[model samples]
Target chain A: MTLETNRQLEDLVAKAKSGNKAAYSEIVRMMMRPVIALTHRMVRDREAAIDLAQDTFVTAWEKLSSFRGDSKFETWLFTIATNKSINYLNSAARRTTERLDDVTVSRVSNSNPEDDMLQGELRSGVMEFMKGLPGQQRAVFNLRFYHQMTFEEISNALGKALGTVKTHYREAVKKLREHALAKGWTP
Target chain B: MNCRECQDELLLYGGVEALPEELSNHLDSCEACRRYLDEISEIAARFRADSDLVSESVDVERFVEGVEARIGRSRVDRLPAVTWVRHVAYAASILLVAGIMSVGLRYVDRDSPVNGVPPSTDQDYYAEEELDEGVVDIVISDFSSRGFLEAGDELLNDVTEDELKYLEENFDVRNLLL
Candidate 1:
């Protein structure tokens, strides 16, 4: 982000900390999509992702006082979202009981009926392949490709070594490639 | 670069990262490596395209409204139950401690030997009997021991000797002995 955008976010954070609900609401608006996307990719459940995203914001609002502004607000937000997603993924009950289905995909997609159906199939396929990845590797892949995060940034967010983050990203890509090849999806 | 080195660099190349000149040159000369790179690129592209599509298709307004509703409900639901339980537990603990202390203080004050005087030491009080052989025998059993005798004697100190003898004759010694 640019310096100006950073300043704007810090100003909003300051306002929200001072009990400005509007500012907090605006922060939620700004962060909701990425948070939901991150969670959806990790949990592979739309309703759970939406719930987790909302919970992330709620928790952030509750603990906003501890946010020292040491890192970017987006980084702090992403860390919370990531941890929540990983937690949901790690929960055995949720993993075993909550299978991805077409209904969930259709409900989450806002496209036209036909497009929604096709996109839902494609998304489920992608999610199925992604499920083969370990949670951390999948997280790395999603954060890098979907959110366009730098490896260094991901390392800081995950509290892992830079080399480790790179390895995860590489392994994620290699696994996806292998899956794609196995299914004859290569272009 | 060899095929292994080329394969290792495929992901980095597919991600468009700057690579060593040797790897770049190998990719330029190698069709197999190029095909592998294309496959990785295709997979990455597919992921990116799907991500973008999903991003555009999410309902932002619905999500924001849901979050607002949850936050409102949480604010209302969270505080009362926790505060009530905490206060109830605190009050119960205080009441329990007060009741114990009150009963303990009453027992100690009522059982003390002399009025406004602390109970006597163990060696200062004893129940003794003189046999026909003129031997003094001290009863050291717990119920007849020094502290029990002090408390019992303090309770009976004002009684007449005849009354004390009558009470002792009427009281069942077996229960106290057990």
Candidate 2:
């Protein structure tokens, strides 16, 4: 978020607005990781997350002319990505086909292999715990805890009232902790 | 404040935000609340850690390529449909112009003869002669008055001026002369 980086991004956005595909591709390259990460966390499916990320960029490109520069480009992009992910999750086809048990959590612990397995178990357990919550609550939790976004920003992105977003985060935390305890996690 | 109230505030903010002085004081004196705070902190830490791990594991190149491929395919898919519409429009325009030209040509052909024959030719003069000999005589007299009789005087030399006046009176030859 340096001034120089902001300038560079603005330049890219300007170029993209003028129909420069290369500039847009660079913007995509710069944003693809976080976009995919946010989308992956939301959808919990890699392929679907990739598809959503691609779709988010495609939509952003198609609507580039309508961008009024009222907000940061990243914020605008996140709004589109969040809505797209939420809509996909809410779709009947996705609802019927998406399975919580399909996720295979990988362990990244470097202490010991036994500890790694336990950490992997805990990670997977947390993911499964999160899957039981509603999509909006889970999104709020992801944005708040994982992405470290303020509730106010999440409210703007999700188009929900700030109080409602805070309540969702609180409820999500309560459910997640309860699920973790129910799964024999201490604390 | 009571433990329940402190814990409720902690649940909302906890490790995510700095606790107020009152909540911080409560946690220092209460083991249960301290443990509760620790548990929330641990959960948040674990989630953050897992998120970091997941982010680190993502294949940036693969994701970029996937996005590029999807965009390319979408553009490619739309191009043919757009080109087809354009082609259809062009063909319709060409047909429209050709139809207009054909109609105009038919109108022109109907207005004029097709064999290069002038409408006011010698055959038309002969047809008029068959219609009325006296009318022909007046036509010849009118032509002679216009100085066109030098080549055809032998044919109308017998017709007199009085005969021309009678033809003009009976046949309204003045309309033709005009």
Candidate 3:
């Protein structure tokens, strides 16, 4: 982040702490992209991701006064976002009557079983691979990889220890790698 | 060390902290394991890159509106700010109304026979006014109501020293304050 932007963020944080609605709104606007993107990857459902992201922001806003600038605002926001998504996933798992046995993990293959699939098909294929991951692993992978959050940031956000965060991240990577290799991915 | 141990420690290779020196030295010497670690790192990177493929941008406007509304409601609920403010405002209004009512009562009393009705002595003031529970309802509404809250708020906030002194001397205004 640029120095100017950082200063602006500090100003926003100050305003938000003082209950300035517009400052809070601007902060939310800036964070919307990463929040949505991370939620989408974690939940694997766009509509659900949006809902979870909204929930995350609402939770953040209500809890904004408690924020102490100990962590970056985005990191704090992501922590809340990831937790909300995880909780939603947990609740949905309980309410869902769908059979896990019937749920097939999707595969992404470039070699044509069919002649010419579009880029969208290829993207969907990758998504299917992601959707197959266990929930927490998916979350760790999404935040670390896609959101580019450091393990320390993840740990602080998730209220986890450094070892635990690293474990989740490593396990997530190892699983994805093993899964990819098993399906004959070269690089 | 065997491949299993190597892989386990390798998992920590990327972010392992406070490692035993012996294991760290072994990792340095083992070319095969080093190659494996490099491959793992590359695989992790690829997977990280692929995560972006699964995500799409979202509608900021719609999302912000929903988020703002929910946040506003939650703030109100959590802080009790809305309720408290309403209580304060209603109390103030009620006090204002009472002040107005007292003024009207005084004006009417100026032409009446009984100068000493003693402020109706809490004798179902509604029934005496022939009000069908409506006036009573207005005065007795929850602390959140505009009429009661504003009136009470004003009484609490704007009460004169003399009025408070009077209540202190003659009434349990302390208990009423709570």
Candidate 4:
């Protein structure tokens, strides 16, 4: 979808490629929020989200030569983000990375600590439930529900078949619905 | 299209791309499909809201600068050609220093040459001088053993008492013969 001006984006990309500081900075400014948002949803940790976003841009810069303007720059950017996010998730899973304990500890320190506690509990419950999902399903759910990516966009970004992406998303939604319902969320 | 097909394509519709006027008009006209479309749109809006629920504003300037700095540092790190030149210059410097040291050492303390390069101390000079004296003595001994035996006898007898005593103390002819 033509969300933004393609000619403007093309100009920005060209200027960035030429080592123009202002152009590069502008590109980062525009892409950072969406990237951070996507990573935050994918990993479900703000700090980790920031790290993942930074890593994503670093990787993109290094591999910028491979970006052949075949798709929208944002699409291409998100595609890089998707691969990086998935790889991060897989690597963290393989290494058995633990959830943030500080979030639990700090739950009692907020001004309205009860609200914080409830939110924290809900967040932890959802995260734990999400952890049980298969990798591709989890990714699809995060992209679809959290990043607001369409099935076709997600399919393109992940380099997966459209059917496969849709299937994973459907399965993810089904699993999440089951989990939420079991946890006493009103249907 | 059937409701199922329309449901499947609803997400693409939500993205608000250039849709055919006929499909748009159909969604507007059909109550059942419109209800389905509204539900899908509601779900999408909820997701959009969730995506927008960012707690903090990202430091875009800092982040961009940080990434740019990182890229710059990495580029600097890849100065292989410069590194090679520096390394060669370093090696040349060391070799030059060693060559200067060797030349200075020879000039400061003359002695018998080593590989055509002179020794580097007074002690070495004296040691080499002694070595030359020993060689001369050996050559004389070899001559005496063959047919130059009378030369040593005449030289020993021809010397004065003080001179002979000095020669004996320094060379020790009796010890040498043994």
Candidate 5:
């Protein structure tokens, strides 16, 4: 977010927009962390997340020429990644949702029975909790809570209305709070 | 409002800010619902403090390689269409140029011969050409071989112009350049 870093990023984007693969490669290295992190959170599978992220970049490259500089490149990328994840979730909902829920619930069930968890354990625990939510809720919660994005931004990213994004977030919080209670968590 | 409606109001309105009066009254009397609302608030606050977590298992090099491969494959996927277009354009250009040159070469050399034979019309010009030249060739060759043409310049120099004119009028001489 620093001016220098942002300037460098814009330069990279310009080069990439002109079809510079090396510049795009640099961009991939720079952005891989957050991109993959968001994707992994969305899909709850590392391999699928990587595949989705790869798809995101390839798509971005293919369409780089059409990219007008209206939004931050990362925001644009996050939007694409978010939508791709949502589509993946929607298509695979019947096949994979239950399986993923089982994995997350079982893992969370093995967490410390005590109401309180250490910060590291809590973070991982929350990650698993996030993984357990339904697709829209997971996406809304991740963008809203972790990214601190406004409801408006989440709406744009998810291609949903403002009301829908808020609903999804609230639903996610309710699910988390109830799950925490079931696990004897204090907060 | 009952607990279910109370919780739903809290979720929809984001706590009691826009909760209906009935829901507010329910929350005041219900300790469990109050705790539920408080827990959701606390979780939100806690999430704000933690930074985003990235999985350490992601291999950047491998991921980059995969993207590069996909890009290359997609380019390859798209290449055939462009190549086909180029192929059609090139074939059209070759045909166009060849047609133009064919017209041009014909225009520049209307009577140009191929393999020493002139192009002709409906008649068998080959047979006509052979008849025209065959007699002249035989006369020249025969006269030279008989020593008549070989000795004719000296003999012809002695003849008068009057005699040559007589020969020209008396013999059918139209085929001769004289």
Candidate 6:
């Protein structure tokens, strides 16, 4: 997951490794959304996303000494985040994913599917469409869409092959379009 | 290509930019598949835009504080639940061994008759030396999981395997340990 800003986080990482809580806090502030966004898409819930994202940050802090700076900080950081999210998803203990309350658009609550496809409902409709995607596909699509990560970057972040990542993205696109047409969205 | 095959092919290039002759001819013959590919592109564009609109805004300060609070604990204290269980089990095992040793050494009646007969001459007994004479290395496989057990402070090696099994069966060890 790439941050939009190109600000260097390595200096902060060094300070953090040397036991600067303030520096670590700054890193968390910078990375909170991208990490949360990935977790949210992976787990499909708000509270769990925050919990897993916090776990990622805390784990990073504990393991900060071992970070060799071999890869970009964001790449390393996202690898941890993505792995945690995937683990939580695979773990039987993961809480059932409630539709994220933070998502702002509740799932097209107009009672009539056709009537709900008005101009104002597209955002929520899209949210509904996205919610229906499989967890891995959702993770792949969101990393590409929100973070502007290339397929290779997402593949590295997700620990998937580049071809597999593209396949996930392509499948996700196909599913979303089919879902939209089924919901009466015209060409 | 048939519609399924044609759609699969179109889904790859995502709406015919470099138009392969075979797929282009198929698309020209098939208006519905063309419409399907067009809708796929449109959906992708709209999805990108609309997903951006859904607010994923996080409370940064609160989130940072949460991370800070978690990391503030010692690494051992912050171990996950399964690891914590292993730690507790290890610590409890040491305590159990010590308790069993004390029970075996002090409470066992070496002179008592067993079912109206005298005890075997070769039966194992407690050592003459006390519990503090030597260190008992309780070799827990995962060292990180061992939290308690201050080494030589609790060594009770005099208890034999028979004594441990007998004591384990006679006593409610799990309840006693916990």
- Per-prediction RMSD in angstroms? 9.5, 11.9, 16.5, 11.8, 14.5, 16.6
Q: Compared with the true structure, what per-residue lDDT tens digits does model 5 show for residues A64-92?
A: 87678877788778888888988887885
lDDT of candidate 6 over B131-156, digit per residue (tens): 22222223222223433343211222
For every model shown, the clashing-pair count is 0, 0, 20, 0, 0, 0
Runs in model 1 deviating more than 4 A are A1-7, A104-121, B1-6, B9-13, B16-38, B52-59, B69-178
lDDT (Cα, tens digit) per residue for candidate 2, span A1-187:
5788778989999998887777988898888777777787788787787788889998888788888897778878877888899999999999998864344475355689987887787767766776777899978887777656777788998989999998899898888678767776655
Off by over 4 Å in 3: A1-7, A92-126, A148-156, A159-165, B1-6, B12-29, B51-56, B76-80, B83-178
Please name the candidate that would achieve the greatest lDDT relative to the true structure: 2
Give the per-residue lDDT digits (tens) of candidate 5, residues B105-129.
9655746664576656635443334
Which residue pairs show collisions in model 6? none
lDDT of 4 by residue, B1-178 (tens): 7666665555445433344575677677678877755655554443343322332356667778877777776543355777898999999999999999999997665644656866667675675555545545654666467544465655555555665565565557655543
Q: What's the TM-score of each model vs. the native?
A: 0.62, 0.62, 0.58, 0.55, 0.56, 0.54
Give one digit per residue, the lDDT tens place, for model 2 in B1-178: 9999988878778768788899999989999999999998887776666653444566777766766677666644376698999999999999999999999996675447625754466565454344556646566566776554442353345456765565565456455444
Error of 6 at B111 (Å): 24
Clashing pairs in 5: none
| Candidate number that wins on TM-score, 2 or 6 | 2
Docking class of 1: acceptable
Docking quality tier of candidate 2?
Answer: incorrect
Worst 10 residues of 6 chain B by lDDT: B128-137
| Model 1 lDDT per residue over A31-92, tens place | 78778878888777767777888899988887887899877788788888888888888888
